[model samples]
Target: MEFDYVIIGAGSAGCVLANRLSADPSLNVGLIEFGGSDQSIFIKMPTALSIPMNMDRFNWGFESVEEPGLNGRRMDCPRGKVLGGSSSINGMVYVRGHACDFEEWREAGASGWGYADVLPYFKKAESWMSGEDTYRGGSGPVKVNNGNNMKLNPLYEAFIKAGNEAGYPITGDYNGFQQEGFGPMHMTVDGGVRASTAKAYLDPVKHRTNLTIMTDMMAEKVILENGVARGIELTSKDGKSETIKVRKEVILAAGSIGSPTLLQRSGVGDAASLSAAGVEPVLDLPGVGQNLQDHLEVYFQYKCKEPLTLNSRLGLVSKGMIGTQWMLFKSGLGATNHFESCGFIRSRKGLKWPDVQYHFLPAAMRYDGRAAFEGHGYQVHVGPNKPSSRGSVSITSPKAAQKPRIQFNYLTTDQDVEDWRNVIRLTREILNQPALDRYRGDEIQPGLSITSDEQIDQWVRENVESAYHPSCTCKMGDRDDTLAVVDSNCSVRGLQNLRVVDSSIFPTIPNGNLNAPTIMVAEKAADHILGKGLLSPIDAPYWIDEDWENRQRPREPKNAMM
Candidate 1:
């Protein structure tokens, strides 16, 4: 098969590219997905998110090669191998990192990607339920709505109030003008169903005559000739191999781990390493998979004095009822991801933006859909958003099917350690606030006993888990940088007609969940690929603590005008 534009890995970015590029009718777009359709009810229903994330049928189930920083633990890295990619199995919380995150991107050589340069694309992709304003889109492909747009659960409101009581600024919407402070978090959900890229961008455009989607087809390697990526060698699920030609460009949307490994297997990486791995080196680029990053988190738990948490609803009968209600009406407890409340805060004073993020869930549980406590309890999922530690993704062989080695040297820096300590300390302060006084019980994790820098450090090493936001392997950077993989336009530094889109091209991991920003990247990239001029940047205002130089947090809570 031959197409003008071929996009590998129909994840968040690939789906968007397929829709946009194929719109011209003159452009034939082929989107290749390693996994099959995302039609399972487990994926369709937002509450069943955990099932798909852990299932091998939907997730890549890639595990890291023992992290040295985590006491030699090999963390589970769940990348979606299905139609929507990770978005199908993700927590569905929509967050675009702090505005300043893009500034750092520009600083790292991803020019024209500053907050002002990229914010328009973010608005272009979002069809927010709350309607359009200066910062959000109202009628875009991806449907986004405030988590629990209605105040169905008091816990959601309580968490936001608690953040205020703990002296954090309370914004109406974090994804709006202000990214800092406590606010209502969003989910890519519409009509009680997931708004994954497949559903949002691909579903509506699937019938386009110029677009072809191939599922259960593995991309073996990019077929390069004269230093130009011409096409790709693909393997069918039944082991049949075929070559598909690309006339214009071959886009790699295989995500952070997959993209870098694909580049390596295709002989586009470190000359010495590729030669050692039995692959002829096409380029001497040493930065193919070097700058890996992810957010590491721990659930700060507290036993609830009252049975207000989701733990009480984990029983089979309760679950059955929730499922029945959702199946019949698409409403009820099952419709929500239950991460309605959240916050972003600076770990220390004088920081230009938030370095920590909080996802307040009503149940004290692990991300694996397992309860940590047998009774009613709640937990605040807190993590350092801006990590300094770096790791890598590299190929040990030339085989396309072989999973690449991934190591996200998490918590290796002193800054990381300090960030963890501050998030934990602040979480304790928030949980102790009068807003939670009636419901809060004993601290269940890191306990009240796990105080001090040494104790907190040890506890974090033993308990912290990956937030599953792996990114920055084929990071975009300045052309002169030897370690830079892609340039600002996402074009590989030493190659032609090849580009890497997705979080893999991120120069730095953003402050919160990656789904929102990844989609934004694809939306922006689609325009780039189409030769369309960028949407005009909106110089919107955002919140920054005016007293940050003198205080880490407000000394008193300000009453929000209702």
Candidate 2:
């Protein structure tokens, strides 16, 4: 088969590219996925998110190779294998990342990717439920809203109010004007159904004659001719292999892990490593899989004094009611992911932007919805967003079937370790504030006894888990940077007609969930891929603590009790 554009991996990025590229009838666009359709109810239902996230049929099932920083433990690395990719299986939380994060991208040689340059794309990718503003998008493919507006449970209210009681700023919307504050969180959901890329971008345009979607077909490698990507070889579910010619460009949207490994398998990564993996070297790029980064979070659980948390409704009958309500009226507790309130704050005084992030959950249970506490309780998931530690993802052998070796080296740096210590202490302070006086009981995960610096470090090392935000494997930079695999336009270095449009091209992981930003990247890249004039930069105002250099947190409560 031949097409003008062959986009690999029908995930968040590829789905948008497929919809945008195929809009012109003159161009033929093909999208391929290793996993089947995302038609399962678990994928469509917002609250049943944990099911598809851990299910083998929808997950890629990648794990770290006994990370040295996690005390020789292998962390679960869940990347999406299904049609919508991780967006279909994630918690549905929507975060655009702090604008300052894009400034950092510009500093790292990603020219034209500063906050001002990319704000237009971020605004274009979503149709926010709150309606159109200077910053938020409207009439877009993806539907987003403040899930349930934290009204179903009072615990969400307590968490945000508690942050203010503990002397923290409270912004109305984190994705909007300011990010360094506590406020309501947005989710990619509307009318009780998830707004994954496949559902939003692909479903409405599937009948287009120029577009083709092939599932259950794994991409083997990019076919290159004298250093130029000419086609891509894919293997079917039944083990039949074939090469599809690329008449225009071969776009790699296989995500951080798959994209880097495919480049290595195509002999485009570090020459020495590719040769060692039994692959002939086609190029000497050494940065295909380097600069790995992710967020590590530890859940801070608290036993509730009242029967007010989600735990009270964990019985079989209650779950049945929730499912039935969603199935029938598309309302009730199943309509949202229940991650209503969140906070973003800096760990230390001198940092201009928030380095730590928090997610307030109404139920104190494992991520898989397995009950951990016997009765009513809640938990705050906290972590350092801008971790300094780096690692790599490299192929073990020249085979597409083999999972690549991943090592995040989490907490390997002293800065990362110091940040976690602050993360636990700050979250504990927020949960202990007077707003939670009526509901707070005993500390659960890192108990009240775990107070010392030594105790905090030990507890964090034992309990910290991946936030599922892996990125920066094929980072973008200028052509002069040796570690850069892609240039400003996401075009591969030393190659022609090849580009990687995904989170993998991110120069650094941002200060929030990667879904919104990943979609924004693809939206922006679509213009470049079509040779259209880029979106005009929007210089919108953003906020940071004015006295940040002198104070780590607010000296006194900003808002009095209402």
| Winning candidate number (lDDT) | 2
lDDT of each: 0.88, 0.92
How many residue pairs clash per model?
0, 0
**Which lDDT tens digits does candidate 2 get at residues 1-562?**
9999999999999999999999999999999999999999999989898899989999999999988887888999999999999999999999999999999999999999999999899889999887889889887888998788998889888899899887888899898899988999899996889999999999999999999999999999999998778899999999999889999999999999999999999999999999999999998999999999999998999999988889978889999999999999988789999998999999889999998988899999888988777988899889999999999999999879998999999999999989888888778877878889899888888988888889988888888999999999999999778899999999999999999999999999999999999999999999999999998999999988889999987666544321
TM-score for each model:
0.98, 0.98
Look at candidate 1 and give me any clashing residue pairs.
Answer: none
Candidate 1: list runs displaced more than 4 Å.
556-562
Which one is best on TM-score? 2
**lDDT, candidate 1, 1-562, per-residue tens:** 8999999999988888888888898899999998999999999899888899989999999999988888899999999999989999999999988888998999988889999898889988999887898898999988888756647767777888888877788888888878778888899888888899999999999999999999989998999999999999999989999999999999999999899999998998888989988999988889899989999999999999887788988889999999999999888778889888899888788787888899988898777788997888988888988899999888988887888888888888888888888888877877777787788888899799988999999999999999999999988889777788988888898789999999999999999899989999988888888888888887877777778787776665443211
Instruction: Candidate 2: list runs displaced more than 4 Å.
Output: 557-562
Q: In model 1, how large is the Cα lDDT of residue 239?
A: 97
